[model samples]
Target: GAGVSQSPRYKVAKRGQDVALRCDPISGHVSLFWYQQALGQGPEFLTYFQNEAQLDKSGLPSDRFFAERPEGSVSTLKIQRTQQEDSAVYLCASSLDGPLREQFFGPGTRLTVL
Candidate 1:
């Protein structure tokens, strides 16, 4: 019963650079989601995937952001051409299968752009 995990815990990048963040969800889970949380703001849904199929990605701010859940488990979020406004905590969560199910979240990957 492994829990969700994120790497780097923190990332500092120069504006216009590309950054990739990783998330490892619990074993056997079928649903995953990525969210962005700005300082003093609520986490906003960025994308969702059921297994390797991406269900939604309308929340991604722009083409600069991309995500994928290959093999229906581990996921990665990549932000290209980073900007100061892009600095925030990127969170990943996983659930068993429905909206009613509880989603477990990792500590998050805090990104800082300079």
Candidate 2:
């Protein structure tokens, strides 16, 4: 892809339901990241992948939040048993390497848990 792309710009999920958000990063990028952004707040890193290896997942709010980059390009973030607190914009970004380099971000998947 020419730029990062995320599916379902907005999602509405009832509490306790599971949802999966997709992301297609720029072609041949080596670093991918998932971030959670609450309304009126800055994005916070949720996880990072260097190629197919998940090197960091320190910022995931809880066990219900899971992310994966199986083929080093496309990735998915799944939230299980969603809670009201989970309502936020889930953003995905890709870079040539890591934070040391500039990254391009997708518009994001806004998840609203009710």
Among all candidates shown, the one with the greatest lDDT: 2
Question: How high a TM-score does candidate 1 get?
Answer: 0.96
Q: What TM-score, computed on C-alpha atoms, does each candidate reach? A: 0.96, 0.97
Looking at model 1, which ten-residue stretch has the lowest summed lDDT? Answer: 97-106
What shift in Å separates residue 94 of candidate 1 from its native position after superposition?
0.3
lDDT by residue (tens digit), candidate 1, 1-114: 778999989999999999999999888888898999998999999999898999899999999999998788889999999999999999999999843589989899999999
Q: After superposition, how far is residue 55 of candidate 1 from its true place, in Å?
A: 0.3
Highest TM-score against the true fold, candidate: 2
**Candidate 2 per-residue lDDT over residues 21-87, each given as its tens digit:** 9999999899999999998999999999999999999999999999999999899999999999999
- In order, candidate lDDTs are 0.92, 0.94
